[model samples]
Target: MMFQLQIARIATAPLPVWIIWGLGLVTALLLFLSVLLHELGHSLVALHEGVKVRSITLCLFGGIAQTERDCPTAMASLRVAAAGPLVSLILSGLLLGFFPTTKSIHPLLGNLFGQLGALNLVLALFNLLPGLPLDGGLIIKALVWKITGSQRRGIQVANTTGRILSLTSIFAGIWLFLRGGGLSSLWLVMLGCFGLGATRNQSQILALQQVLRDLQVADAVNRRFRVLEDDQPLRRLSQIRLSSTADQRPANWVLVCRAGRWIGYLDDQPLRDLPVQQWDCQVVANHVRSLDELSCISDRAPLWQAVRALEHAHDGRLLVKNAAGIPCGTLDRCDLGEAVLHKLGVALPETFLAASRRQNAYPFGLALSQVVDSMTATDLTEDSV
Candidate 1:
């Protein structure tokens, strides 16, 4: 509807309704295409720097390019961040320059070119404002990273600046609204809110990442597993279950051994499949999985490594091993979250922990996978430098 009104205003003379609507549709598509091109510029530069582009998504706010990993150096990050705005600026220049030539051919074409060019210019300039989640913020992050030689410190600076800017923008929008600036002012408020929300989330994630870096996988391990002989009859499972209690519950996972050496694991499916009558005849040997099939993590590794490994695992679980390379226990997203909260001196109730475990999610609904990936990438970059 806004596009329709804008198109009607742009039309110098009365035209067919169909033609007006068609022009509006074309204009909208072209504007979005410009945004896509801008994001593409960033993706291409990142690719050239050996970063894999995961996806490019165009949204109502704008477009974003997600990379598989961070750039390995400050210079590479700067280049990747600047490419989008640079593309926008170039497009603006080309369109604005071509508008005059179109004016002599057709008035509508001239208006379209003029508006598009001006919009692109605004897009470029607006995104150049220094704040997190924006191209300019990334540039600032790169500069700080280069100067301090620490990506975490760079993120802290950028995020703090972004939060300040977001608050200022929100207030400015409210002032404008109070002064009768209307819907335009509302857009400003919305943008500011979005920025504030994004920055705050990033801040939390940063804090979590720092906690993970300071801790080890052993801190999050739950010794709720049992080691069973591969040759044991399936009836042993029923006995273990009957002997378990609330405080002394049996392991959810049962590791298998053959000839006193670790072999595989007993999956839950077979336990559910065999009835009481067949349990005595069935053996754990045939139902055991190979050791190589499990996702394993070392207790000596930092917690962030376990987070990343679990995020990529099919079951969202890890078999944890001690410093001696012997599997000691298991860790899941909930267990890891408990460790993090415990480190922060925050205690959760048993009910919340139980719910999180059932849902197979982190406590308090925290999302740590992406944060781990990002922080780990930054560590790699710092190590290389």
Candidate 2:
């Protein structure tokens, strides 16, 4: 059975699918708005610091503020991060004040606004926890940087704090589940899981940044890649496998090229799901993910910045462009990993087999575990301390 259905079955009965979906949509929309306001707070502060706000995206996790440049000082970074939660808190307070002793407004709307206000309050409070990727975490990191005179040490400390918070939340969530609470308990567990994953990702990115401080995109790009025409049939490319024998398959995936320009990407998953006979009838253009909406990085962009962009975009791959806005190469997470490892003077294995395995086992997960473990390793790492 699908995970969605399994979760639904575990939830309360008498909750019809349409109603549940409606409520979910409403909640998502509300959360999106709240996150937007929060990110806007950050963006506004970033603008004041002469930092450019690139864009904002609202996803299942929350909203993110994409900035064109990093803040020049620890104080600026702290303020930029703190601005979001501060806005949330202020908005919550305003809502609470407006609804104080309310008896005139409809009960349903009042309840909704009250819940919204409460959610904002929770958002503010939760974000205040000292950890990386959180406003409070950045604030604490800034303070640590100020004292230690080391940005790396400050990030390490903040990330460690984040992992501890994540673990505590997970434990608390499990306890809540054991107590026979409903969906709210399950949601707590999921939230904790999400927080853990996000915190770990943040730490991994930081580690890579530290390792590849001066590296650029030009250092790790696969310049020679095949670009396919939109009208091409998948059968032709599938026959000519570029990789080894083990990787040979129907070439349903292709990079869309038009008028000497890289336009988009096309995958064969949807076509493969259908009957084999229907494959010839489908066009590759139909499956394309538009390049206009996808993230592309300049060839001269720093490796660390490119990695951050990939993480923020959550896309495994990005098209590398030259000065003339033409596609020059492709850069993915693996390329970034290899570059970092190479720069660190890690030995390259002789055989292709060993190299592939080593590259695949990049220390992203272990690095995160270490970051978290470091928090408990010292007495000063405790939250109370």
Candidate 3:
């Protein structure tokens, strides 16, 4: 009986499976190929506008064409942004036009062409919505930028509009769900959420870029920091306490030194775990991460460079050194948060200010207070002292 069932399955599966699989693979390939063509349209336009094309990538949803650098002008950006949608629209028109002719050839091929045409049309129209991270949003941004002469102002307007549109879509999705749309409504809601997130994220990225523009990491540096001898007797560590001076806030990091050189750093977490009795028996060198394992950035480097380092680093706090190869200070996301807020001209909220001042709760010192005024716990990590 099992053999009979298996034989039945094999006979039934071969024809339909092969045909469906072949058709499906061809359809998917064509869709991605169309996406690649759309991205190429953008890349070609970018090249025409004197912007260098880095690469064109076909993604699950669509495609992305990256430029080596931002377009030099608003008009240029607008042209580049519009190019992909224009290509999709053009492809849709061609497919629809040719679909009628394909009907005589084969039913499967005809249906496939019809579907592709419809999808391309939808893709073009959907992407035309004025939301950030979308082609239409870039067009809107370019238009706004051209009129206002400020790229930041353009991003603000486009992102605000995008958020509003996303909310509308979300509400519409909820309405659809109430009307028993089921999976379709859920899909709409997901798209709305994705759009909303993308818009906000792109806006924040623009803001961060502008705020950190031409700014070096040195501007946020606090010259007053503490260093410890790695070979020093651990019993003396109890005497070392954070000092709040008028000139500087407080030292966040205690750099470990060996032979008069900064070799590593003592982690405050492990030290706090030990009893007072064991302090004398342990050496400071044994409790610290070696310099080789530490992430270091130059004081002269840009704030963005430090940010990139911190993003990929195991520790949030970086060992910042001066041109003289001496440890000047530590750079953390907190400092960046403070600087970003200062750059954006936003006043620190009272509640946030109060929380950052709680030194005992966090790893670092009072300098963190300045940043806590502007940044949240998500922006900075409490991995170091």
lDDT per model vs. reference: 0.83, 0.65, 0.69
* Candidate maximizing TM-score: 1
Model 3: CA > 4 A from native: 1-15, 210-219, 225-385
> Which of 1 and 2 is the better model by lDDT?
1
Winner by lDDT: 1
Comparing candidate 1 with candidate 3, which one achieves the higher lDDT?
Answer: 1
In candidate 1, what residue range of length 10 has the lowest lDDT sum?
A: 376-385
Prediction 2 TM-score vs. true: 0.52
**Candidate 3 has which clashing residue pairs, if any?**
252-385
User: Model 1, range 1-385, lDDT digits (tens) per residue?
Assistant: 4556766776778778998789888888999999999999999999999998989999643588988878888999999999999999999999999999997788788878888898899889888888899988899989999998887777878888888889989999999999999979987788899899989988887777778888899889987777789888988877776666644322377788889788888766777887779888899898988766888999988888888888777777888988776788899988999999998889999888987877779998777776776776666412321
Better of 1 and 2 by TM-score: 1
RMSD of each: 4.4, 15.7, 11.1
Shift in Å, residue 258, candidate 3: 25
Clashes of each: 0, 2, 1
Deviation (Å) of 177 in candidate 2: 2.0
Write down the RMSD of candidate 3 (Cα, Å): 11.1
